[model samples]
Target: MGNSSSIQAADASGFTQSRSLSRSFFGAAALALVIILPGCATYSSGFAKVEQAAAVRDLDGAVKTLDELKLTGADEALHHLNKGTLLRLQGNYAESNKHFDIAKELADKLNAISVSEQLASVSVNDTMKAYEGLPSEQLMLYSFKALNYLQMSDVDAAAVEARQFDIKQSQIAKQNADAKYLSGAFVRYLNAMVYEAAGERDSARIELQKALDGYKKQNSGFPVPASLTADLARIKAGKPAPSEVVFILQNGLGPSLHEATVRIANPNPQNGSSLLSLAVPKLAKRSVPVARIELSAGSAVASAEVVEDVNDIAEKSLNDRLPGITARAVARMVVKNAAVGETKKRSNELGAFGLLANIAMDVGSAVSERADTRTWSLLPGVINMARLPLPAGKHDITATYYSESGAVLATRVFKDIEIKPGRKAFVSDYYLNPPAQAKAPQ
Candidate 1:
C-alpha cells in the first residue's frame, strides 16, 4: 500500500507550470522522466526459485540457493535471518543462533543510521543502498533466536531473547500508536513458558498476564486459548511443572512484496501532457499451508492455536512504513523537478551538456528504482503452538498439520521425545504447504 497516492499528489497545483518547450531543454527532460523511470526494477523475483525448492521439501536446496546469493549492506542482515531460520528448521540450533545473532546486530546497526541516508538514495538508486528490515521481520529475528535457545535447552539465553522481543514490541507500538493494528501474543506467551521452565513462577505469571493483554488488544475475534487458560490456572496453583512439552508450529509462507506503478502528470503541463511514473512497493497475499495443528501424545491430545499471524505482521509493518516512504518519494521527485528547472535557466553550450547529463541521470535513476524486496521468505505465514504435559521419560508424540476443512495434510510422528524433571521439552516444525497444493509464483 505504499505510494498509492503518488499520482493524485502530483496533480496538485505545485506541479502545474507553463514553460517554453521549443527553446528550453524542458522537452528532453520531460521525455526522459516519462519513458526512462518506468523501466526500473520494480521488485526482485528471484526468491521464487527458493520457494520452488521448498515446495518439493528440499530444505537443503533452499538453503544452498539462499546462501549462494551475494548480498551487501542491509541485505546482508536479511541473508543472515533467512539462513538462520532455515538452519533452525534443519535442527541446527547452535549454527542457527550464530546467524541470528549476527542478523540482530546488523539490524540494529543499519536502523541506527541517520534518515539522511535517504537523501543519498535519490542519486545513487534505492536498490544500491542498505536494506533496513521491516519491524515485523526484525521482531521475528529475536523470536527465532529465542526458539533456537529453547531448542538447545538454554533457558538463560532464551529468557534474554524474550525480553528483547518485549522491548522491541513496545518500541514499535510507541512508534506507531495510531496504527490500525499491531499486536503479538506468541512472544509473550513463549516468554512465559521460558520463565516457567526456568523455575521463575512469578515472572512466568506476569508474562502470561501480558500475553493475555496482547490478545485483548488484538480484538481479532480469536478466542482466548484454552491451553493458555489451563497453564495460568496451573501456575496459580503453585505447580511449576517442567514435564510439559510445547510444540511450536510455523505454517506456510507469508505474502511477498511487489511493485505498483503510479503515473504522475508532467510537471510542465504544456509538454505534450505526458505522464511521469513512480514505482512503489506493495504486498501481495498468498495462501498458507494450514490454519491449525493438532498434537497427540498417546491419549492426551490438544490443538494448537494462533500465536502469531505473520501475514498480518508483514502488512501492518509495511503500512507503518508508508509515511516515510511517501515523504522520500515526494522529496526525490522535487529534486528531479528542480534539476530540470535549473537546466532550462541556462542558455550556454555547457548548459546544453548539463541537460543531456541530467537526462542520463534520469535514465540511471529509472534503472535503479528497485524496491527493497528482501525478506525472510522461508518464514511461516502463521505461528501456532500446543502444550502437553507428560510424565518424565521418553515418549512419542504425533503432530497432525491440517487445513480449515479438517483435511489431514501431513502427519509427523516425533519418536522418543524426552521429558525431564522440572524441565520442558520444545519441538518445532513448519509446513510450507501440503504436498500437491503448492502454487506457482504469479
Candidate 2:
C-alpha cells in the first residue's frame, strides 16, 4: 500500500521529471529509447517501470531498477518521489517521508511558476485518454502513485487515481472482471483501514464489511488480512482480543445410514462448540460409496472435503446376517473461505435458502446452465445441506455436484437466509439425481 507522504512525492517527482525531461536532450533521448524498445523491454527503460514494480510489491526490483536508470536532467522532484515510493515499499517510512517532502517542495516550486501550464491543465478525461495510449512504463508510474496513496491511508485520493487508472486501462483494451474487482476491493479495504486508524469503529466496520462484500461478489475467496480480522473481533467483543470460529464436520457410517456430526471450535475460552447432525440414507443393497463430503460455514459448504474412503470386507454365508460397519471422514468449515459473506433474508425466504440465492448471485447466472451441461463435474463439489448456519446475520449457501468423471454436473445456490444465534434455519428440500443416489439411503 502507498502512503500519503509517498504519494505527494510521486506526484511531485513525476511532474517535475516530465517538465525537466522536456527541456533536456538526454531526457528526450531516454524517452525516445523507451518508445523504440520492445513492448517486453526490461524495467530500466522508463520512469513508470519503477512504479509498476512497486505496484506488484516488487520493492527490491523497483528500487534497484530506479537506481540504474541514468536520467540526465531528470527532475530532482521526480527522483525523490520514486525513491520515496521504493523506501515505503521497503518499510523505510521515515526515509520515504523525507523524500516525499522534497518532492512536495519541488511541486510547490513548479506550481508557483505555473511551469508546463498545458500539462497542469490536463483534465481527468484527458488524463484518462492519455493513459489509454500510455506505454507500460507510464502505466507503472500511475500504479505506483495509486499504491503510494493507498499505503499512506489517503484512500479517497487513491480511489480517484485508481479510477482513472482503470478507465485508462479499459480504453486501451478490455478489462477483466477479476482485475477490476481487485482494484475496487483494494480501494475499499484501504478506505476501511483509514476508518480504523481514525478510531471510528462503526464506520470502519461498515467499510470492512463493504470490502468483504465486494470481494465476495467477485467470487474471490481471499482470506481477510489478520489486521482486519483483529479489528472486527475487537468491535464485536468491545475489547482488544482476537477470536475465531472454526466448524468441523465428522462423517461416520451407521447400520443403515450415513451420519455426520458438525461442531464449532471457538478459540476463545468463553465460546463453546455448537454441534449438529445430518442423517443421510444409505444404499439398500450395497454399501455407500461416498468418496467425500465437503462443508462450509454461513450456509455454504466447507472449503475442503473428507475424501479417503474406508472399506470393510467380511466373509458372510448366504444365510448369515451382515455385520455392522463403521467408517469416518472429517472436513473443516469456516466463514472466511466463502467467496461472500452471509446473504440478507428477503420475505418468505429462510436463512439457508437466502444464503443459496446470494451464492447464485455471487457465482453468476451461467452457473445453473453450466451445471446442467455437466460442467459441475469439472467444478468443485460441495455437499448439499437442508440445515445451514446463520448467526443472527445474512448468509448464502450453494452446492455443486460432480460426476464420477470429475466433471461439474450441477450447481445450486440458496440465497438470503436469516437465523438468530442458537436458532435453526431450514433450506429448500432438494435432491440430487444420480446412480449413486440409488445406492445411498433416502
| lDDT tens digits, residue span 1-442, model 2 | 4698899999999899665534443432333233223212222235445544643447688788777765432235456655765575475655765765565455445433333432321210011111111122223334345445544545565456544545544443353333323333334444454444444557667656665655455343334444445456666676632112221111122112122233333353112111211111122122322233333354444432321111111111101211211111111122211212222223114334433443333232111110000000100111122223345665655555444556664455546544434333333211223332323334
Tell me the lDDT of candidate 1. 0.71
On lDDT, the candidate that comes out on top is 1
After best superposition, candidate 1 residue 361: deviation in angstroms?
A: 4.9
| For every candidate, C-alpha RMSD to the true structure in Å | 11.1, 31.7
Worst 10 residues of 2 by lDDT: 370-379
In the range 170-255, model 1's lDDT, one tens digit per residue, is: 88778767653455566777888888877778988988887787777765456667777777888988876657778988888888
My TM-score estimates for the predictions, one after another, are 0.82, 0.27
Model 1 stretches astray by more than 4 angstroms: 1-44, 122-129, 179-183, 265-275, 341-362, 365-367, 434-436, 440-442
For every model shown, the clashing-pair count is: 1, 52
